[model samples]
Target chain A: MSLILARIDDRLIHGQVTVGWSRILQPDQIVLCNDTIAADPWQSKIYKSAVPPDIDVSILNKESAAVFLNNLPLECKTILLVENPEDMFDLVRRGVKIDEVNAGGMHHSNSKYEMFEYVYVNRTDIAYLRRILNSGIPVNAQSVPGVKIHTIDKLALDAIESIMP
Target chain B: MINGLVVTHGELGVELVSVVEMIMGPVSGLTGRSNSGKSVSELADEIKELISSDNDCDTILFIDDFGGSCANAAQLAGAAGSSTRILTGVNLAMLLDFVTWRETMPIDELPRRLVEKGRQAITSMGPVQEG
Candidate 1:
């Protein structure tokens, strides 16, 4: 498929994606799908600046990203980045085909609990992730390339059981 | 006086600061941090908090490498037009140069000097001169 790597990381266009994953994936284009960032020119500028000038960079909202990914050229290798699981769910719901989802970073907050070193999730995040999982797409948590990939199913199940009455 | 914060992947930052301090004696305004357990945003927030804690002095963030998580977090922390400066590819010579000239040099010009010093520190001995 043209869409090679689809990932969920809060810090989009950062080192892990740019240096770590990009070097391995070697995608021709990196597309960031986020509504808030796409809407803000200044924010878009900052994110775009982090990427190298050689590779193509596009920042589009969910709807536009869905359309773009649907029609992407077969030869164009692309890395799809979304900030959160909600965005991934929305993209999947909007008919953006993805082979697998890499869960990179979901930093800690009061509302979230640590699932892995780089992954923190709350009930809402778990629910959305479950929805994505149920759609037959595998979600794996791996911070950088060449690291061990952990499936989110067991962790999500444990988390869901803990939160339920 | 300008303060420096060394941020790296694991214990590299901490060890670099310690070695520099060992060579040049104790330094008061320099610290090291690790990105072992923290995520990018968490690391960025920690950097922001550190910068805000000592608001009087201009801070310089020494990152292990460019296009790494430490550098990325440093960029995020410094993106809002703060008085902080980020220098990637940090080395012992750069830290030494910073400690030596921080009090004398202006913050704006210090990064360029450190970059030069860091680059100059790397050299080959040309296959060991004949005795």
Candidate 2:
């Protein structure tokens, strides 16, 4: 199955993902893989409510997602939604092919370093993305499609290290 | 061309204006005034001056809270003779509605339309209860 897109957005299934990115990607199903959401049925149900009527939504954890992605047919068009860079790398290490990564939205925690507007990253967070980028998989930071896509290159990653631990 | 003015206790007016602009593009004929250090009378006078100055279009005042200082001031500021009216609980959705329908909709019906917009925007997104 063709993995149409893999997006790392904390707000897994919101307007930006539902309306904004879905308009561009138009995948058959949106598989939101998050540890917390997978465990909490209430959270999963809430997230699923945001999905469009025509499309499918799957809320799975990292292991289940890897298994599902591995088993899909070559023609299956699915969009993988990961909450953080760590989970993204988990899928990558599990032999999932990710052509590109889109960083949609990451609000600030107490210790987060604000990389861009509405995007925050910690030391470990940026490190994970940097690892993926070093492997030649480019991470493009764009909250919504049709907006200016900022390539998460060496310069952008280096800037975050200065402000945060 | 109805001129819209937002008056709030603090930065809600400014924040709401920013949200409206962020969703829509750069807009004109709309302004936001925050009551940081001004008293109720001073705020009322400030809004009154703005309402008086712009006689070209019907000015609509959108305040933060109902039955509060901001709302009372806005009500006092808007002229009774002219077509100046005040709308309370001015959220982004309401402002967007006003921005979209300001040209076509008359000043008399704009409040009801905007109030409906604000009401419709708030949804209990959880599972619906079957009757």
Candidate 3:
């Protein structure tokens, strides 16, 4: 199938995805779906440099991304990258047939707590992730290929209790 | 915070950490050791002391080169505690990656992931990366 993996990573395309995941998934193309980057030409070029010469890179907004993904050749092996959980949520809401998303590299920030060394989230971030999970979409959290998969159990429970007294 | 030790020939390891600290702020859970004046056994003992004392978190030992005395000493020290992992050819990016990622990875897997992260950071300069 053309769509080998759909991934949501905060850092977008960097070393871990290019060298690490690409070695395992072997995608011929990488689609980065972000509204701001699509509108900005220079930012798009910067992301392009990070990708290998052999692989193709597409930076597009969600609406355009839906169209671009729909039109890709059936034989084309592609891995779609999005920076935010909401963007992935938006893609599926627009009817992109992404069944699952490999969640990776949510780097720590002051407002965020470290779930793992590479994965970070705030209370609000967990809620957004739950939205995807509740919609029957699987969010597998793991940084490198073949490493242990991080469960959303703690985040999910926090999301549930967040609404309660 | 996990523990880290950067081992290098002469004072390179010590100086690299100083540069890294300048760039990334004061890094916790990391130390730098140089084999400049110390014997292999002395260096190995220093590593073992740190590894044994850090009872809370896992430790990663970074070496500047492989097949050298520094690497040998690190490997010998790593044997005493399975918590210690030695990665050869440690660069600036690799050290940054190790400190950032040690929390997410088990001691057994941190070195592999850090190596990959370091490899990704290295590339021939291009205009697209310019500010």
Candidate 4:
């Protein structure tokens, strides 16, 4: 119930999340919705150890996260972190209220459509984001708070070809 | 005057603050040191004094490591004193954001803002490089 901020940063957990995000978000719970990290004890331990002792970090997969998020206390500020658009789409399809997603850093990839210099989007990803935005969730292209904002769906997608080879 | 304290091991705490000062002007009344010599309980007691003295409704003590001595001290002090937030594993981006944002927003928003800033700072640029 306390899903304050949900981010889709490929980097599930790192210095930014443990040190930077933890400091800023001040969330009592840091929920990472990545299946791989959840199964691997070594990886989970490493991520948990990285976080400060004060905050609780849980690594859950997309399925379990749905159940967990339902039971989470309303008072606790929970941050849901995902790796890519696929995972986010999966969650969205499952009825997760992900309003206003900040495309932090998707990085450069040879995808079907080139949205921008750094972001290359495919048809499915583009459609998904367009739907999410049309639903009234403000999807902005802001890496940091200080950086310039780039409207995701509003970007000129006419020039972006659907060819991926 | 808002007071900030950085607590860490060896020179990590001081080094962090020095980096902050270099970029974002001078932060006055900021104190930091290694919490090695004293016991955990003793160190916590000392940190309490630091926070209480400068803790006039607004004070943040940045701890270098969460599981480390400095963070433990700040957490303990939080119970004794009022309005003292402890941020562990202090980093340049986080310190800058906290110090910069706290000036405008209310203290209540400090934690949320910190988390947002922290999320953006993380990067999966590549596999970790070993020197």
Q: What is the C-alpha lDDT of each candidate?
A: 0.86, 0.82, 0.79, 0.68
DockQ of each: 0.03, 0.07, 0.09, 0.04
The order by descending lDDT is 1, 2, 3, 4
Chain A TM-score of each candidate structure, as shown: 0.95, 0.92, 0.89, 0.79
Model 4, stretches more than 4 Å misplaced? A112-120, A134-136, A154-165, B1-131
TM-score of candidate 4 on Cα atoms, chains taken together: 0.53
Candidate 1 TM-score for chain A: 0.95
Residue-wise lDDT of candidate 1 within B1-131, one digit each (tens)? 99999999999999998876544445788999999999999999999999889889998999999999998998888732447899999998898779878998988889889999999878863432222
What tens-digit string does per-residue lDDT give for candidate 3 at B1-131? 56888889988888888756543445677888899888889998988887788788778888888899999897777643576677888898888667566677788777788889788867887566533
The weakest ten consecutive residues by lDDT in model 2 chain B span: B122-131
- Stretches of candidate 2 exceeding 4 Å from the true structure: A1-6, A14-31, A49-57, A62-80, A90-100, A107-114, A142-150, A158-165, B1-4, B18-30, B36-60, B67-69, B72-85, B92-113, B120-131
Most accurate candidate by DockQ: 3
DockQ ranking of the models:
3, 2, 4, 1
Across residues B33-129, which tens digit of lDDT does each residue of candidate 4 receive? 6776788889888887776675355777777766877777777776324466676666677777776676676656675677677666677755433
Candidate 1 residue-wise lDDT, A41-156, digit = tens: 87887788778777899999999999999999999999999999999999999999999999988888787777887898877888889899889999999887656778888566
DockQ (0 to 1) for model 4 = 0.04
TM-score of each: 0.59, 0.61, 0.60, 0.53
Decoy 2 TM-score against native: 0.61
True contacts kept of each: 0.00, 0.00, 0.10, 0.00
RMSD (CA, Å), candidate 4 to true, equals 12.0
User: How large is the i-RMS for each model, in angstroms?
Assistant: 21.1, 6.1, 10.4, 8.8
Docking band of candidate 4: incorrect
Task: Specify the highest-TM-score model's number.
Answer: 2
